[model samples]
Target: MFRILIVEDDEVITKALCKQIETWGYIGKGIHDFNHVLDEFNEFDPHLVLMDITLPFYNGYYWCTEIRKTSKVPLIFISSASDNMNIIMAMNMGGDDFVAKPFDLNVLIAKVQALLRRTYDFSTVQNNLEVHGAVLNLNDTTLNYENQKIDLTKNEVRILSTLMENSNRFVSRDEMMQALWETDEFIDDNTLTVNVARLRKKLEEAGLENFIITKKGIGYRIAE
Candidate 1:
């Protein structure tokens, strides 16, 4: 059975959508923590995600990009924002389909079925990033080491993803910020510093001391 994760903010909509998804013989889980949607995502480990465009703290695009980093799971954007720009942005941000609000339930179901068939029919092994006996489960954004599983926030996941993708190579701060912030919003330099500090602290606590090393004035890297 397939599982769908609904990231809608409306209580009625989330409940209704989950009901319909359940009726379709698939399990549905609704995200409760808007501030930490990724956490719920990792917990549920849905096959498909039903997301809205606008959300608290960050938008659907940010989450979509974040999810894309770890998994190729399909996502459909269900929102009242149905303009051409919104639709195009949704696709650009990795949405498999877009269902405008005031949409037909039958049509939404058809799309959902189609995307599930297309995405999961021929899936491959999930990838992980391993370094220094610490393994990062890309699918669920968890770091495993010494029999301990450390859940990673969206930002921390992206940070580790980028660094590990270029393992042994320094990834500059600018590159990481671009990877994290695909939107036009300006992010302060201190924000990156804060995120990296938190990530480093987590690694240290997990017994992987100096898992991520600063390259002087360059950037950071995970040594080979």
Candidate 2:
């Protein structure tokens, strides 16, 4: 089932929207800590985001751009502003659509369904990995961090993907070698070490420090 993240601050509206989502056969998650919206967002990995223009901490536009740096997920702005300027600004901030507040539940569901169909129907399932604000794009083998994008090599991609998949679990050197063995290239001990070191350097250069932890004799892991 597709998951939707709702960032509306109004408790009454959030409750009503959650009901509408369930009625339409979709799961809905409401934001509790507006300060950590992105953290919850990364954890939930929602298929689409319903954002409000006016928020307590940063506005929806700020979060939308931050999300756009790493994901192409659909973002729809929902606010009572409904002004032409707000609509245009939302679009400029990479919002897929706009839903004025005090809206009809049925209409909101319809717009969400249409956007979901348009986005995911023609694309592969997106990856949901993050480190220092950089997202590993599994579908395209790209690393996006702070709006800067980088192409990952096959070996680099595998190493990072494996580490991210088991973020809190220590992955032994042998396990990493085994992961590399699945590739077309025959990997040796030196080759695996070289690739891993290179990957670490790349991640570090991208503003991620101590991302991959070495568990002395145990293996490696991305510290949660």
Candidate 3:
């Protein structure tokens, strides 16, 4: 199912939007932590975003710019600021469309459907896995943490993806090896160890010490 993230602050409006969105067979979530909008966005990995211009900590344009850095997901701005300047600014800030406040629910849904169709028709939307503020872009196999982007080798990506996919749960060595085997590379026990060590080093260099934890004779998991 396609997921939509709503970044509005008003409780009533947010609830209404979510209800309307879900009624149309799409999952909708609202942002409760205004200060961590980007964090929520990463965690939800929504296929599209409905953003408001007026917000508590940072405005919609700021969050829009941040999201654009890593994703090309369709974003629509819904705000009371319907002036031509704000509308143009929304587009310039990477928003795909603008919907002024007091908009008809049907019209909004139509816009949402149109953008979703236009954007996803030719491409698939790959989601990012986020744990402890670290975002792993499945589309590009890169890691983003604290404003730093770290490139990962193919094996490193597979290892990290497996661990993060089962975050906070032990992933046995056999299971990890199985994940790596999908790459059709010759992966032995020693190779897994070396790849994990290298991956851990990269995480640590990015200030993510202890991001992955190990248990003797067991396996590894993302730190809880």
Candidate 4:
């Protein structure tokens, strides 16, 4: 089932929207902590986002811009401010659609279904891995940080994918080598070390110093 995230602050509206969304067989999640919108977004990894223009801490446009830095997921703006300016701003800020408040819940559901079909029907959905403020784009094998994009080689992509997929814990060298070996590459201890070293250098150049931590003989993990 597709996952949708609701970024509205009003408890009643969020609850209603989530209940309606789940009825349509889509998983819906709401943000409880306004200050950690992006963190919640990363954790939920929603396929689509329902954003409100008037949110606490930061507005929807700001969060939209931030999310566009890492994802191309379909975003729809739902707000009381449905003026021409707000609609235009929403589109310019990377929103795929806009739903004004006081709208019929059925109409909103239809719009949501239409957008989801239009977006997912024609393209494959890719999820990005985010650590700190840097985002790794699995679709293109590039890292985005501080508004800079760094391209990665195939080996680097494999190494980073492995480490980032297991960001919660240490990934042993043998496991990493196996990940690389699946690509039919000649991967051994020395090759893994060189690839990791190169990946680290690239990360450091992008201002992510010590992004990967080594635990002596245990394994590697993304810095906490």
Of 1 and 4, which scores higher on TM-score? 4
Tell me the tens digit of each residue's lDDT in model 2 across 1-224.
Answer: 89999988999999999999988899999999999989989999999999999999999999998998877788999999999999999998988899997899999999999888755553355455776577988655678888877777767887887888788689988999887876547898789889988888887887777878887789888867
Pairs of colliding residues, candidate 1: none
Model 1's TM-score against the true structure? 0.55
Q: Give me the displacement of residue 85 in model 1, in angstroms.
A: 0.8
Sorted by lDDT (best first), the order is 3, 4, 2, 1
lDDT (Cα) of model 2: 0.85
Cα lDDT tens digits, model 1, 78-127, are 99999999999998888878999977877898999988764444223446
Q: What is residue 149's positional error in candidate 2, in angstroms?
A: 9.0
Residue-pair clashes per candidate, as listed?
0, 0, 0, 0
Candidate 3 per-residue C-alpha lDDT over 1-224 given as tens digits, one digit per residue, 9 for 90 to 100 = 89999999999988998999999999999997999999999999998999999999899999999998877778999999999999999989988899999899889999999887755542354467789999988655689999999988668888887898899699999999998886536899999999999999999999999999999899999999
Question: Lowest-scoring 10 consecutive residues by lDDT in candidate 2?
Answer: 119-128
Please identify which of the two predictions, 2 or 3, would achieve the higher TM-score against the true structure: 2
Name the weakest run of 10 consecutive residues (lDDT summed) in model 4.
118-127
Instruction: Give Cα-based local distance difference scores for all models.
Output: 0.84, 0.85, 0.89, 0.88
What's the TM-score of every candidate structure?
Answer: 0.55, 0.57, 0.56, 0.57
